[model samples]
Target: MKKLFMPYRGAALQLKNHVVMAPMTRSRAIGNVPNELMAIYYKQRSGAGLIITEGTSPSPEGLGYPRIPGIFTDAQIEGWKGVTSSVHEGGSKIFLQLMHTGRIAHSSNLPEGHQVVGFSAVKAAGEIYTDNGMLEYSAPVALDEAGIARIIDDHVKAAENAIAAGFDGVELHGAHGYLLEQSLNPYVNNREDNYGGSIENRRRMAMEIVQKITASIGADKVGLRISPFLTSNDMPSYEEAAVHETYVQLAREVNRLGIAYLHISNNPGIPEKTHQDIREAFANTIIYCNGFTAETAEEKLQDGSADLVAFGRSFLANPDFMERIEKNSPLNELDYNTLYSPGEKGYTDYPELNYISSITS
Candidate 1:
């Protein structure tokens, strides 16, 4: 069998295949809670070995996007229970991704009393979509020592909640210029305290969160996703050497903690040496995501670059993604419209191979 279709047994994850479903935000969670529609959506695409859920806020303050789900409340946890149960019934492991959109947020998206907070008070130079249409990002309240402590505690509790909700594990959203990645960027984090200044200081918040979460929940049930050079969400480019060192150091520390995996959000800006360095430093499973077809993903697995590969748009468009790959069938094109709109039109209405065959016959 091909490496991509072969079962993977490592890092305490025994997956049915090496293919993983990358997390993509589909704003179908009405009232900021998962529902039966979301459960059906996941169950349809459970052909992948592992599914990392969409960005779920760990607290009320982290709900920076309109309609994104949260795991902080009892209702949210109960909602996610249905989704996890469905995924498990389909014979796939699922992980809840805890993402806190820090400076990359507008006040209109947050709850009544919660305000946007981040490592520093600097606002990201971009507009986020809200119910009131595109709005400028609100100025974040720079977190003091107490605020930072609270953020860490929130993550720990979120991870615990994920396990309670029937998740196989939890993945920390340390990539994509979210709250954790906000601290890594020096241009955004201008604090003079211990959590700022040097490379060690810049990575302190993320490292502390990983360490604490691993302590609270076993290291085997945790994964961290990171993008070293991809400057999404108004993140400015810094010194090249500093960027390389920051992630390499991070890989080493996480390796020491013995986490389940390190998910690298692959991009063109990331140098080959950095990839090699990260692979050498971290001995656990490493998943490479973004812009991969089955052929390329299979090559990545065979070439020893990645133990597993994740597909975002492919799974989003094709529910039986693994089946299509196995049969060498053409994939359905993704509809640009309704990517984040409510309802099941472009979300769960995608046809499977059987449906296509029936129509043609």
Candidate 2:
């Protein structure tokens, strides 16, 4: 009864192994299009089993990181084609994460002549990165029902674009207080309309996007990422329940449609009870990320708490992460200084499995 490299078999798709590289935004793209260098970076890690590409805007309004890629434009799609080709040649599957930043944005990063939009007109707390250092976020314009419908359409178009770009599927960026999460957060969303007021209503918009995208491209090609529960003790109780209920309801709805996966990010500082809820709520493949060491990943996998583990910072520093973990090898500590810095020095220059082999050769 020993399975060192168990395959990840879901309802419709199958990954060669359980090691999935979590999407991390590295500001290295050009004009919001991933470059040839970015392609090589991901291709080098084809050993990850499954690689979730960096958060890509589903529309101009979804812009988060200044240099991050998008799935909207032909140029963007063509840019991703190179990346997909590279990853495929290395023999791996990848998903493009459709990220809509919502209230978590500044005017500088928006499309030319574009304004930020959100579920509510309220402003997000703290500073957002801008060309002129970090600046306070301005109050975003609340989306009318028409605007909400348009965004859903944007996600659908992006899903189609993802498929054309050679992505295996698209993962909706619904967590981390992004646009979808903003709708679910009571603190952020104070609307009295059908998209708000109650937990069911709060979860409505995200569900609609899921239904639209999964329909546009089969549900089996779609995945959702959420960090419904936060480690911040500062979050209100109502917000926590809304997050919890949203995840459960979204999972049930999408699970009914046979979606590929649901990724839940658990901040290490949070209480343990949330794990019990995630275990009971998600019936399909549930991927757990955030502070998951190798031993923890194995433990949770064996216990059926999660189907796969998403390694973020570790994968950044160690491109051969899957092979390393498979062989119980040590990892190179990540260089935080280079983490979103403007260069390939730390991004693509990280050592690969062959490099490590040569060291031992």
Candidate 3:
């Protein structure tokens, strides 16, 4: 139980404790650029041992949601510099999560001349919120061989950009039915080439991206996030055996590469035995996230099931989350309405434990 508060070292980054702040999309970046407001929000939550930022696009075409941040342009790089510096000054390490929306994107959300592309021409089933209102997703252009090569190059460049922006590492968003996940889905990827036949073929693109990112920046500075059989974002559900086979193969490959860590988006609902299998297969640092409380996290740590635990909504609403756990203090309830809205109302407005007396009795 005491282990959750102890310092731990991974392949490249050192953390003060085991509580990671999971990556979540907060559509606060106006004009697709990071700003001082975003920096302030991250700085306020620096109590986290590590912060995996909201999904940030690796390129212009990767932009899916309105106002989501990007890491490609010079201005965007400069903007993230402010964020990384702020988080560092407060004594926390941060990793940028690179996400490509694939067929899940709305054309209006992207820049001029940019079109949505995916593993195949299938349209993801869902609506994305825009300035006007909810808009249906459009079918994407399927990538050819040259297109696949370009995507790999884009990922490598984004990884380098992340380092330049003062991020300690970069996480490839391989989950949530995004570009990488779409390729992994048998139902979505109907290609005949080397990239889309068997399980190994389907996993090719994801593996290639991981390899490229690792080559560009040492494996120690890269992490991959995967959510097996996640249904969100129009991702199809696979049989339990298929899910296990696909993820385990991925786990074994990444483990061989000796990447920094594997961040598993494990809801408590996932079978415990399956989680253990992947854990043993990787045999490296694992950060598990999904509705974990202080007690439950401590239990996982004590049982050696997880090396670190991630807090999402808890840390989102409580800037002093670690301190709150230490003191057993009550947490502020999150206002869901303001989560994706612009400005600081539901973001930096959450108070620290010490600030309560100044705000009220």
How many clashes does each candidate structure show, in the order listed? 0, 0, 0
Residue 244, model 2: lDDT of 55
Better of 1 and 3 by TM-score: 1
lDDT of 2 by residue, 201-257 (tens): 888888888888887899889999877666231223355554556666766777777
Better model by lDDT, 1 or 3? 1
Instruction: Name the TM-score of candidate 2.
Output: 0.93
For model 1 the TM-score comes to 0.98
> Residues 20-53, candidate 1, lDDT per residue (tens digit)?
9999999889989999999999999999999999
Candidate 2 C-alpha error for residue 304, in Å: 1.5
Cα lDDT tens digits for candidate 3, 1-361: 3777888786666898888999988898988999999999999889888999999998898897889999999999999999999999999999999998888899998888999999999998879887778999977999998998898888899999999999999998998889999998988999999999788999999899899889888998888998885778898887778878888899999999888889888854466667878888886789888878899989988888888888899988998898899888999999998888999999989878788977787
TM-score versus the correct structure, for each prediction = 0.98, 0.93, 0.97
* Model 3 Cα shift for residue 177 (angstroms): 1.2
* lDDT at residue 287 of model 3 (Cα atoms): 88
Model 1: lDDT to the true structure: 0.93
- Comparing 2 and 3 on TM-score, the stronger one: 3
Clashes of 1: 0
